[model samples]
Target: MPLLNSPRRMSHSLRALAWLLRYPDDEMRAALPALSEALHDERALIAGRLVELDDLIDRLAHAPALRAESDYVELFDRGRRTALHLFEHVHGDSRERGQAMVDLAQTYERAGLLLAPGELPDYLPVVLEFASTQPQAEAREFLRETAHIVRALFTALLERRSAYASVAAAVLDLAGERCDKVTLPEEPSLDESWAEPEAFGGCSTQGQSRPGQPQPIRVVRPQPAATRSAA
Candidate 1:
C-alpha cells in the first residue's frame, strides 16, 4: 500500500479516536500511539494544504475573512499535535521539540481566534513570530524531506478533484471497489455537531487541550422563561 494511503485511513481513525479518548477509554489509550500514526498522515496532508494556503492567502488577499486566521491556527495545531505524537512515540521519551510542539499548540489555543475574524496583517506577524521561534533547523529538515511526498499527495487530490471522469474510468478498469473518487463538500463548514452533549463529553471542540491551558468543560444551566402577560 502507498505510504499516503495509511495517513488517509489514520485520519478517519483519529477523528473517531479523538472523541473516544475523552471518556477514559483505557483500551483506546493503549492504542493511541498506533492511532497517532494516522495523524502522521494528517500532518503530511496539512503541510501540503499549508503550502497551498500560504500562496492562496497571498492571492486572495482581499479581506481578513477570505482566509480566516483561525483556519490557519486550527491547521497548525492539528499538525503540531501529530508531529509531537510522532516525536514521543518514536523517542519513547520527552524532548524539546515534542514539548515545544505542545507548547506552541497550547499557545495557539490561548490566542483563540476561531470565531472572531481579525485582520490578517495583524495575525500574520504573530504566526511568523511563532514560526520563527520553532526549531527551524529541525522543522525545515523534516519539511524538506517530506516536500515531495506531500506534493504527490496533493497532486493525487487535485487529479481526483478535476479529472474525475478519466480518473474514475481508469480506476474502474482495475476491478475493485472502483476506487470511488472522494470529493469535498461545495461549502465546507466546521462540524459543530460535536457541540451536542453526546458527541463531545466536556469541551465540544476537537483537539487536545494544550497542557496548562484552561479547558472548557460545559456546565448545564437553566434560564428562566418569560412570564405570560395579558393576551
Candidate 2:
C-alpha cells in the first residue's frame, strides 16, 4: 500500500507520465517505445496502475500521429477542466497565480532546473520533471502537497472519459490518496456557458487608457547592434 518508494523507479515513472502528458508530436510518437520500456522497468513499483498507463501508451504508440495530436489538443488545450497547468486549478489568472509561479520557479532554480522561456512553472509535466530530479522522500512530499490538484484533474478527466485520466489517477495512487471528497471546480462546457464574446460590456476601446487606472508599460530589452540590424 506504500507508494513507489524507490527514488530511481519513481523518477522513471514520473518522467514517463510527464512525457505522456506533453503535446503528442512526432517526437513523442517516436519516444513511445523508450517510454514504455521505462514504465515497464517501474512496473512493480507502480503495481496495478501500470496496466492503465501501459494500455494508453500502446494505443497512442500505434495510432496515427496526427490523430493522437488532435486528441491531445481537444482534451487539454480547448478545456480548462483538463488543463495541464496546475495553478489554473488553484490560482487561475489572479495576482496570486503570478506570485505562486515566481515561487515555484525559484524552487526549480534552487534545484538547478531552469525552465525555458514561456514555460509556466506549475505545468504538470514541468512539475513532474522537477520531481524526477528530487530525492524519493522529497518528491513524495511534493506530490502529496499537490495531491488535491491531481485529484481534481483526475475527476475532470474521468468526467470527460479521457484515457489520459489514467495518468492523473496514477499520480494520485503514487501520492497515496483517493479522489473522494474533493470539491472540484465547476468547469462548464466551453461551447455553452464559457464562450468568449466579441467585446466587453463596459469597455469600448481595446487599448485606450482609462482615468485613474494605471496603464501597463511594455519593457523592451536592448538588442545587440547586429540583431537590431537584422530586425
Candidate 3:
C-alpha cells in the first residue's frame, strides 16, 4: 500500500522537499509534477537551486524504475552518512538519541502532527512534515538548528555528485544557512560491516504515548452508593 501522506500540514514547499527525499515508489514518481510546481510556486529556493532540483526530478521521473529505486537505496540506505534518520548524525545509536526522539515526537504531537504508525520522529522527511505545520519563520528556525547535520549530508552528497544533493541544498536555502563543506570521517557501510549491538526495541519513539479515540466518561452518582448499601 502507498504511504498515506494524509493531509495534515500546510507548508507546500517543505512538504514537497520532504517527498523529493522519500523513496521514489510509483506514487512518489506520480507526484513529480506537483512537487516541481510546489518548489517553484513557493519561491523558497533560488533559480540555480531550482535548476538543480529539476535535474533530480527529471532523473526520478524518467529513469528506469528499478534503477531509480535501487540507486536511491544504494545511496541512502547503505550508509549512515547519507541516512535520512537525522538523529543518527547527532546521537548515533546512543541513549541520548532515544531521549531526543521522544522529545521531538512530543513536539510534533503538541503541534498536532501525528506520525503514521512506524514513522520515526527523527526521520528527516517526518521532521520536515512537522515543520511544514509550523509558521514559516518557526519552521525555518527548526531547520536552522539542524543545519550542521544537513550541511554535512549535503556535502557528502555533493562529494558523491548525487543529484539528491539539490534537495539538501534547497533545505539549507530554506533554513538560510550556508552549506560549508566538511570532511566527514569514513564509516563502513552496513553491508560491509554491520554495527555491534542491534537495537533491542525499535525507534525511541516507540515509547511515546499513542492516544486513541476518546471514550465516554460514565458518571455514577449517589444512586450507586445506595445500590451498593442495599446489596
Off by over 4 Å in 3: 1-10, 189-231
Could you list the CA RMSD of all candidates, in the order they appear?
19.6, 7.9, 12.2
TM-score leaderboard ranking: 2, 3, 1
Candidate 2 residues 1-231, lDDT tens each? 445453345788888889999898988878988987888887634556777888889889888888988889888887776889988887766567889999999999999889999999999999988988898778878888899888888888888888888889877766666645356657767785454534543233223445445556599999999999999
lDDT value, candidate 2, whole model: 0.79
What C-alpha lDDT does candidate 3 achieve relative to the native structure? 0.81
The digit string of per-residue lDDT tens for model 1 on 73-115 reads 3432333222212232223223544565455456655555322
Model 1 residue pairs with clashes: none
List ranges where model 1 is wrong by over 4 Å: 1-58, 62-128, 133-136, 142-192, 199-231
Model 2 vs. true fold: TM: 0.79
lDDT: which candidate is best?
Answer: 3
List the pairs of residues colliding in candidate 3: none
What's model 1's lDDT at 129?
Answer: 30
Question: For candidate 1, which ten residues in a row score worst on lDDT?
Answer: 167-176
Which lDDT tens digits does candidate 3 get at residues 62-177? 99999999999999887889889998887877678999999999998898778899999988889888888888778878988889999899988988899999888878877777
